[model samples]
Target chain A: MKLLEEGIPLAELSIERIARTAGVGKAAIYRRWSGKEELFVDVVRSAEPADPELPGTSMRADLVVLLETQRQRGVFSRQSVILHNVHAQMKSSPKIWAAYQNTVIAPRRRLGLEVLRRGQSNGELRDDVDIELLYDLFVGPMLVRSVLRPDGDLPDGLAERIVDTLLEGLRPVSSRPG
Target chain B: MKLLEEGIPLAELSIERIARTAGVGKAAIYRRWSGKEELFVDVVRSAEPADPELPGTSMRADLVVLLETQRQRGVFSRQSVILHNVHAQMKSSPKIWAAYQNTVIAPRRRLGLEVLRRGQSNGELRDDVDIELLYDLFVGPMLVRSVLRPDGDLPDGLAERIVDTLLEGLRPVSSRPG
Candidate 1:
């Protein structure tokens, strides 16, 4: 990830190259991982930052912290390439697909549920909100932005705006209590 | 889309078969469009519905109609497919991607902005919310839910929950004067 994060394109990579770069023998690399694609997936899965604490504070503050830390490294920055490769490869390989589901999608879903549950119990989130559906709200926009505008950066405060809009509602309505 | 919406997989598609099914000559299809891929893109685009009209009522009603109508057919659903295909093709060819962005992405962005602007003018939306970023909030979750959990169907009353949680604020405190 450190290598990919620094903009190492995977097309230029090889198992032999990775071995040399990591200061290990080619045979040693082969014994553990079958090839470059597998190695790349391993790199991504093992390298993702540990999930952040849910904080149990105000939902705003907790969510703000949850997103900001991710922004520091850029969400799915390096993993985007791996994801592209994996999605295509999965067309032909079930094992790769399973690995991706388990390693990538499952963990994120679990973490999202954890935060939402914490927010609910702490009175920082709505009791009626479906945590899973809400997780889609938390993640969907950033993913769309990344897909649509790959070259465009996630502009400053965009994450906060997303969190705000999702929590507060984007509907234009008078707040008066009539 | 009828095919896909009916659960036919992409892997099952063939040029001759699709042309036969649609009652067009294979050569006629090829002369205007290169292959099934281009034909599919055009089919989706041409079928996209116009944007929903915004009633000048409460913001919540306006947003609900906007969201629910978006699900009716066309635009968002078709655009989502285009985005998925574009992302997938990004790894393989630049040409397909450029076509996808030009035909699908730009138009969607424009439509989303229009929705946000209308909300703002009616005093139903926050003056501080960035329109473009707000567009992200509006469209992101819908697309994400479609892509990740194609079968999970957006749950009952989920849209209302999203609006209430976001607009009313998720904080437990009673800030509004009693």
Candidate 2:
């Protein structure tokens, strides 16, 4: 993991080199994983915390946790360097790539949907808001911005603003106070 | 340029290879540009069109052009692939790096400022919309979305919906119609 976090390209890795650096015998390393790619995949899998338990709460609180998880990974974690390398490697390796999509991306998206579904049930979000379409709108822009400006100022309170604005526009118009 | 659009790694480039591909001599290639890096930089420089002229009409019209430009680049263009490679290369090459900052990113930001300034002058946007911050808000999210889901479905009328929502929130509270 440290090797990958240091911007090492995963494709060029060798098991012997990993074992040498770790002060272990090649047999010990080979006993644990099939190859360097599997070892690298294991390292990535170990980075994510256990799946967060979604609380039965208000939409704002639920979404804040969800968005914060993304922000931490997307903006604040050391894993970003690993994610970049993994993103590049996914173009070439299918096994590692499937692990990434399933472990990293799918769960985060599932949480977003859960929050939206909760909001709909509670009447805080509109019945008309397409949960799937709203998910795209909610997530798409931030991912695009991060790509363009990896270290640039993330609009402070962006998730809050998006949620607030969308909720405002989506509420039953007559229910809105002046 | 086509090679980059096809996901060819810039690190793998060689002058002899490029020349053979282009059906030109090494001298002919060197005559046009010093190296593959310079040639690739030239490709990025060539693709940027002059900023669309603002029509000095409503903020909606002026902003429609600006937001649409962002959407096109953020979502549709192969320019993003070059943009990503430029960022990755900046970690290594300082000279090609500095040129990218001054040329590609800074100019687009300045163009954004001009559009916002026009919005304030024409009374379409609120007097206190914070042009610099608004630039970040308007442009940042679209880029974030693109990087995350390069091939995801663009929600129907998503662009117009964003513009409408922003227009509503940014307008003076008193200006909002029932």
Candidate 3:
């Protein structure tokens, strides 16, 4: 992971390097994984966040927490390198791509869906909200920004602002009785 | 552009093939542009939509039109291939990257910002709306979706739905009277 974060090409990730980095024997690494790709997948899978504790509070708070977690994960050192590499290789390396989607993308999407579902069930979100589109709205900007401006910092309170805007859009008209 | 849409790698974009395909001599192409990179940039620049005429009927309509244009430009044959290529090469080919950003990305973003500014002036959106964030909200989903599901079709009325969600969230609360 450190090597990847430092922007090492995926092709350069050798078993010897991993063994040396982790202070393990090459034999130990070989016993558990077939190759660098498999080992890389395992490292990413291990980084998946455990099932998030739902805030069970307001939809705004729940969404804020959810997006904040995503932001933190993305902003972490070297994760962006891993993400960029996987995205670039999605077409050329189906196996690695599948592993990345299954281990990283799918789980995060599922967690987001769960939060949106909770919002809908609690009458905080409009019944018609498209769960998939809503999920994209929640995290798409951060993802795009990360790609376009790798070194740029997001404005403070961006997560809160995204939640506020989305919730404002999602709330039923009748519910906002002033 | 045709060759790129057909998924030719940038390295494979040859002046001889381009000349043959376009029914022109290789000398003719070289006489106009210094090299393939410059020619490719010009081709992309020519494809950019001229300043889009805003309907100004409503924010929702304006946003729908804006996003629809983005979708069309993205979905046009193999523009995605062009986009992916440019993105992948941004680090290695700063000149091409700058040209792409100037010709493709910056113009579209400028158009979006203009529309949002209009909305704010017309009292269709809150003065406090973060224009940059709003811009992302309008197009981020589509961008992310296009990348992730290159072949998956968006549901009908997706443009409308995205606009609806964003407008609902962005309209000033006080403006919506019971």
Candidate 4:
């Protein structure tokens, strides 16, 4: 993981490097994993976001917390670096891509969907709101901003602003008469 | 461009193939551009969205039209294929990366920002709205959805829904009164 964060291409990573970095012998690594890809896949699986404890707060507050946690977990972190490397190599490595998606990407998405579903059940969101689309709207800005300006810091209160905008949009129509 | 859309790797794209595909000799291609990357960059530059005639319409209408146009231009098109290929190769190919960003990404963003600024001046949007952040909020959901489910079709009325949500959020607090 350290070597990956240092931007070493996955194909160039070796058992010798891993063993040396961990102060272990090559035999030790070989005993556990057959090759570099397997070892790296295991490293990524370990970094998956655990199912978060939902705050059970208002939809807006829950979404703010979710986006904030995604930012902390994904942006400017070793996990993010690994995710990028895996994505870049996805076309060539199907097995690793599936593991990455199932472990890293899917879990986060499931958590977001669960939060939206809770909001719907509680009558905070409109009955017609598309939870899938709503989920993307809530997190898309931060994700794109991170990619476009990886070195730049996010503006203050971005999470709150995104949630506020989305909640206002999702309000039941009858509640806001002209 | 046809060859690229057919899934040929850029590095494997040949002048002979292009010439054969276009029913011209390799000499014809070389006369216009030096190499594949330069030729592709030129194709991308030609595809950049022109300065759209803003209808000077309401912010909701303007944004919906803008996003719909972007979807038409970007999703599942030859232009999008070229853009993705260039982005993937960006780190190793700085010149092509710069050309792609300058030609494609920047122009679209400028147009969107212009619309938001117009909204603010006309008092349709809150004066405190962050135009840059607002731009991302409007486009991010569509962009991320396209990436996450490239094979899945967008739901009906997606553009209208996104614009409606954003406008409601951007409406002045004093106007809502609730």
Give me the TM-scores for chain A across all models, comma-separated: 0.63, 0.69, 0.69, 0.69
State the DockQ, from 0 to 1, for candidate 1.
0.45
Better of 1 and 4 by TM-score: 4
Q: After superposition, how far is residue A158 of candidate 2 from its true place, in Å?
A: 5.4
lDDT of 1 by residue, A28-50 (tens): 99999877767766765565565
For all predictions, the C-alpha RMSD in Å is: 6.2, 6.1, 4.8, 5.4
Off by over 4 Å in 3: A1-8, A12-27, A44-54, A77-92, A148-153, A170-178, B1-8, B12-35, B44-53, B77-92, B148-153, B170-178
- Per-residue lDDT tens digits of candidate 3, residues A58-158? 66677788777656655652355565564455445667766766766788778778877877776666656667877887787776665544553566677
| Per-residue lDDT of candidate 2, residues A1-178 (tens digit) | 6677676677667887788889999999999987776677667666744455656668767765665555555564334656666656664576776666665677778878877777767765554545765565555545544544556545567666555544444223443346
Q: List each model's interface RMSD.
A: 3.4, 7.4, 5.6, 5.7
Instruction: Provide per-model DockQ scores.
Output: 0.45, 0.18, 0.38, 0.35
Model 4 vs. true fold: TM: 0.74
Evaluate candidate 2 and give its CAPRI docking class based on DockQ. Answer: incorrect
Tens digit per residue, CA lDDT, model 4, B65-121: 887765554464433656666545554466766666666667878888987787777
- Error at A126, model 1, angstroms: 1.7
What ranges in model 2 sit over 4 Å off?
Answer: A2-9, A12-42, A48-55, A78-98, A127-129, A144-147, A154-162, A165-178, B1-39, B48-51, B74-98, B120-123, B126-133, B155-157, B168-178
Q: Which is the better candidate, 3 or 4, if ranked by TM-score? A: 3
Whichever of 2 and 3 has more DockQ, that candidate is 3
Best TM-score goes to which candidate?
3
